[model samples]
Target: MSRLYSDIFTNRASTGQASADLSEAHPKFAVNKVDFWYPGKQALYNISLTIPERSVVAFIGPSGCGKSTLLRVLNRMNDLIDGTRHTGDVNLDGKNIFAPEVNLVDLRRRVGMVFQKSNPFPKSIYENVVFGPRVAGQRDRARLDYLVERCLKQSALWNEVKDRLHTSALALSGGQQQRLCIARALATDPEVLLMDEPASALDPKSTNAIEDLIFELKKDYTIVIVTHNMQQAARVSDVTAFFFEGKLVESGLTEKIFTRPTQRQTEDYITGRFG
Candidate 1:
């Protein structure tokens, strides 16, 4: 049954202007008829969506609804898991990201990801932010230092951590650690940032901090976030996509999805009627 629906969605995604216009508008990241499987169980249906450039698009859905799966597919993070299979096209700025000729290292550099849990390196706050640029062959101290400050400020952590840049990232609170992780992701100067429930574990205050950072960062980088919090989605995203049972139930402007959803399932889920 899942496969049948996947095929139908894939067909519709491929034979229409949805994919084309998505690329036209964003030209940063485009997923067309995307499908994924883990050892024979389909995890994502033909999920097609366009992420507008320098904008935040939030994915909201119940547990096991494939929100995280879809976010990982955008940056090919699923490839890290064993026995994972994927089909269809994901383009970054009009280039096929899944192409054999594409360099995984470079692709990851362009498309950075922040996981649900904050996993900062054991190194100091300064080291975590400069790690990516160093690995990318940036050897100049001046350039690395400049990037470190820029990224930390961009992630809204510079003012808090600047005085102790040499302090270990692990020494910070959970929220600070997450922001450090975000700074690390930004250090690479990625064109697209994929976040999976980035603030799910933080306190309300910390969550607000992250939310504000997302709102501000969208001015420079395109962001795709998977979040279970409906209000957070409404607050941070310009577009909202509702997923259920591995399918894209509906998507549109955030206001529309929250206040006037077109699908009954979407309305129900948004209004606390059902999962």
Candidate 2:
């Protein structure tokens, strides 16, 4: 690993700060020298990142800087696109995810993802929450009921929709729908949650709600969020990774990366000097 990569696992920030040093946290997912391509162009080059368990890591950079691509790559969401390919390995809990023996379905269940847009199925709210479990051969009504309530509450959506569980999910507001989508992802009992610009489309109030939910959820699930909002990144993430033109420019504690970035490109981007 380079010096920059080594810095990602070091606590360079002072102790009294609000941000805790997460360098010693157990590794949840490790991306090793990954280079990704889509059809005719490359999106990532030699990117390596270590995400600590039960913490939040934010990927922030300008447009087309491979932040979202790396987010999708974590759960192999990029495989759905035609002619998409990558080199190197993405390890989840120290095991290579690219191994042929790995089961994609089970992998995805362990690493649930919420997209840039809220995509609730046409079904009712209750059905949406229980969709993943139901698809996995869970037929017990009582157990499914428990999952519905538990996951909705985890996503902080239970109080608002408790009395209307059977109503169409499409009827909810944009923020509510996003929370529903998060509840749906949670119903799978995922260890890691990958969010791609999850709150970018919502109003300020809704964005704050999502950010609060993220802060609370980090107590249980490791989260990787791809966001363009620098303030949001600073507010919610324990670690921040900045990318530039398909490479990881710098990554470290959110406090250090934002306040004392070691790389010139990282400083420029964060300071609004250039992106």
Candidate 3:
């Protein structure tokens, strides 16, 4: 099992296979030998990955597998917590995001995130969608209206809530609320979007809606999602990475990962032997 995991990293040359070397070929976010710690416990191993531009990459694993931890690292959301330390490099556009001179607020603005649960503020739906732009001091009412409409339309929520823009955001259904959260994230015009189980709490219909939205959004932004749902990862992502016990077991094109993964550990987990 260990040897299976080692082959994905050891043999970096392309073999006319889907799991070819992407880490150095063309990477928008290059994570090289990254290790993370939270006080006494190490949360991530020597992880290296290459996420290309305007693509959707899914991280799949059971709980406590460090998939979500790595997602937060891209935008430096982990910096808000105490006793957290990270080593190695995570470069965006070939620039290190962890450098002392890098501005965290700007980094977060460029990289938006949506949590597992829909956390719409108690504000009106229109207010919720435009909050990020407002914070950036965009005070033009006409442009704010345009921004709100554009983001909501992009997120597939405009048609449902266009008539109720001023209604309380909390009054929407769970699925709609999650979509609203996505609109809010998009309002910031981020280059990269990180989603942690964006549709896990939704009904099947809502889940499909989110999946369709992901398909549309990937054309414009780089997206990384951590989803526990194997089917969701297979459905929505172009590439898939499997992690276990703070280590990335394997990664490849989504179809290949689901059908013919190189690593035994990946195959076992996909086949439901263990997570």
* Candidate 1 lDDT by residue in tens digits, 195-214: 99999999999998998788
Q: Ranking by TM-score, best first? A: 2, 3, 1
Between 1 and 3, whose TM-score is larger? 3
TM-score of 2: 0.93
Candidate 1 displacement at residue 191 in angstroms: 0.5
Q: Write the per-residue lDDT of candidate 2 for residues 1-275, one digit (tens) a residue.
A: 22442332343232222454585799999999999999999999999999999899999999999999999898898889999999999999999998999999999999999998999999999999999999999999999999999999998899999999999999999999999999999998999999999999999999989988997898899999999988778777889999989999999988778777899889888778897
Off by over 4 Å in 3: 1-26
Computed on alpha carbons, the lDDT of every model, listed in order, comes to 0.84, 0.90, 0.88
Sorted on lDDT, highest at the top, how do the candidates line up? 2, 3, 1
In order of listing, the candidates' clash counts read: 0, 0, 0
Q: Please, what are the lDDT tens digits per residue for candidate 3 over residues 1-275?
A: 33432343233223222232335435779999999998899999999998888788999998999999999999999988999999999999999999989998799999999999999999999999899999899999999999999999999999999999999999999999999999999999999999999998999999989988887898788899999987677666778999999999898777678778898889889767997
Question: How does candidate 3 fare on TM-score?
Answer: 0.91
Q: What residue runs in model 1 are displaced by over 4 Å at the alpha carbon?
A: 1-24
Superposed on all Cα atoms, the candidates' RMSDs to the truth, in angstroms, are: 8.6, 5.0, 6.1
Q: Model 1 TM-score?
A: 0.89
